[model samples]
Target: MSSNTIIEVKNLNLTKGRKKILDIEYFSLEEGEAVALIGPNGAGKSTFMQVLMLLQRPTGGELFFKGDRVDWKKPIAYRRRMAMVFQEPLLLDTTVYHNVASGLKLRGFKVDTIPARVNEWLGRLGISHLAGRQARYLSGGESQRVSLARALVLEPEVLFLDEPFVALDVPTRAALTAELARILRDTRITSVFVTHDYSEVPLLAETVTVLEQGRIIQQASPREIMTRPTSRTVASLVGVENMIPGKVVGTQDGVVFVQAGPHRIKSIAAVPVGTNVLILLRPEDIRIFKGVSRHGDNSFGGKVSELLPHNYLYKAVIDCGFPLIAFVNPEQVMGGEVLADNEITVQFSPDKVHLIGQYD
Candidate 1:
């Protein structure tokens, strides 16, 4: 643990009856750092966050705050220093202003100081006009803004967000995410975010931790996680479309050649010859040509098996000995007149192909 680490947990375990919900061996959060916990629905992401916030106690573990041991049984003081926002707003049946001020009152803030803090956060959240409106009468986005104001008014050292935007409409979610991103950046509050949406990770967190079956699978920066997933499961989670199981057939000058499916795929990843591996190719990294091109270096011929429109780009599946997915721009499609069942060329660089060694 570093001197900057604000929170740390060791040997954390949560068991209910015969099933284990969380078995995290170790985890820590540095002061002023934001980390996102993401995985599938039953991946224990929420459970781990709850344990950190002391909402759910682990069966066995030690929790530390600022290098001091925290007593999970009596965590009132610790809890007061942290604030949490849930998926649902869960506001009280009162006016928005009061809802935002309630936490301050409960924490024993002076009556005169509460209004300035509450109103400041309400304004920052762009909901100052709704301060007098009843919480039950506010829209989903409005209610969430009030909830955020309530949490921010406390000026807690750490914040916990549990999929706070999961229930909002796309436009509302995007706007709120933008606002929250700015607030988090400006304040630099240490935080733990539990979310399933990959789109929100880069905007809100500097680091991501992938949890599965109560175990930490991988933890890294968002760019690293998406581009170089450590496992097939992580590749799938981060939207890696082409995961080709292959073997290292040759190596020369730092390039490893893998015979996957019917093509010799070259990659920069270092793996000894004769070892089996999974070749990961993201859809965005592959480029499509209207017809066959003799580019030759990591280029191959393929027939377009499927072409689907996605907003402004076309998602195409090509069978170049091996099936590969690529996102094509409309201009590229029109120039090449590409469509399903048409012969097209697929091209990618060796550095773009990531490899994960398969044991056994």
Candidate 2:
């Protein structure tokens, strides 16, 4: 690797029982940067992570670390520089301190250094108070923290996490995420995380790779992947609720006009004239007004068809010829008039509408 590139996979392919599990043409990770591998279940995210962890060998292609070719026969030597955490905590039936210190013991660290290192990691993971607890008796969140301490205590150059927070409650998940972010920032360790949750991408990664059917469909920054997805599958994976089929009418100046059903929408994106396209809009970007709004370029009269409550907002599905979901504050809907069949206008700025090229 150059000073910038830490891990590089070129034309990697993996197979199990004659079925190809992963086919990545080109992928690279930069030093000290965090990347998220996101996709639906059975998309090969876990299989790819396993390959990187040296638990599985690729059926074809090349993998390099720090510009050195990986030697499969000597995998154990190379694997010491990396550590991984899985969905569940697999703690040994021993004290929390010994579990965190196990890796060091295997590496033949001095007895005097193991306790200090274990204590350091426990404090770092905010589980110092649980150091004396039996590993088998810890709660889910505490066990995950101990598992994290065990991984981080080794000071590996690269870290792999496969849905590490999947089993924790919401508050515990958020707190662990914040703590992991701080540790990664301070340590500057190159990291790869696999997750199916779209919301976790924005919090954990600077770059995201969208995988589908064992292939990388799109890779970009979180903002770019969300706003300018290259394919409809990528758009749906990022929680884009509005993906209306449209035909690009024309482009004038710097704007593109598209026709969806009977509605005309102005887009900041440029597409060739007469080309079929998919217009992607997040529910949070759509605004609802009781009457006409002077701000947005595309506006249509609609009737509120349904109001569904999500975690912290109300998702209102409106029938404006074309259906759309708008997220509004729950407090704003309190004691408000029932929206059923109520006349309303759904509007969105031209910049918020993304035009994705039609993929066959």
Candidate 3:
């Protein structure tokens, strides 16, 4: 473990009834750094967080905190230094103030000093008005805010949140996400946030770690995880809807030409000629024009095979001898130019293409 690393695990393993649940080779969280753990369902994101918080005991592996090996048998001291929030509020049946003050009281905080600390966090989380409300009577958002206050009032060295905002409504989730981001920045408390929603990763964490089938698949900045996913699973999780198999044909002026099915695509990758590669394009990166015209490089004509409404955008599958997915906004959809079986021109810049070498 490094001097600044607050937590580290080596060869971590977890099992239940002869079935392996987590098998991470190594993982670490640096002090004061916010990191997000993301993956699909059954990816062990919550298991990893539970293990880090000492809520779940790993069947095997070494865990270290603050450059010292952790004693699994006596983890109370470490647990005291950390706090966790879950998807469910899991609040106490008492008033919000008492729920927020429970941890401090258990930690033997002086009676006189507890109220100020509790109130500060309640106010900071924008739940002071709900402080006296019964926990069960509060709305989902209010309960979650109380849960956050309960965790943050302890002022833990490490905070572990396992999809804390997943249960709230969209507008509530968005508002709380922004508030939590600002609070995390201000507090500078090291945190490990686990969520399946990759979109929330950029807002909450500076680094994103993708776990798949009990192992770490990729660890990178949010931008890199979105634009240059290292594996097909990560690609799909990050919304890279277009993954085309192609071979590098040639290079000119720093742009590599790729023959993807019947279309020749331009990319800024440096793969050797004749090597098979996977052309990864985010749906948002592919631009759909009203008609066939050379807008720039990598422009071609395609018919919209399918157009489906996805949230606030439209997901279009274009067939230009190869199936390609693109996301267009509602305005573009309302423009009456893009529709099912409509002939449209597809174009994407060379720099927008990400290539992964395909050994198969």
Ten contiguous residues with the weakest lDDT in model 3: 351-360
Q: Which parts of model 3 have CA positions greater than 4 angstroms off?
A: none
lDDT of the candidates, in the order given: 0.90, 0.87, 0.92
Model 2, 157-242: lDDT tens per residue?
A: 89999999999999999899988988887888889999877787887898999888889988999999988888877888888989
Ranking by lDDT: 3, 1, 2
lDDT of 3 by residue, 3-26 (tens): 899999999999999988999998
| lDDT winner between candidates 1 and 2 | 1
Q: Each model's TM-score?
A: 0.96, 0.96, 0.97
Per-residue lDDT over 191-282 for candidate 1, one digit per residue giving the tens place of the 0 to 100 score: 89998788898999999999989999999999999999998778888889898889999999999999988889889977999999988999
**Candidate 1 lDDT score relative to the true structure:** 0.90
Q: Pick the candidate with the highest lDDT.
A: 3
Predicted structure 2: lDDT = 0.87
Off by over 4 Å in 1: 334-336
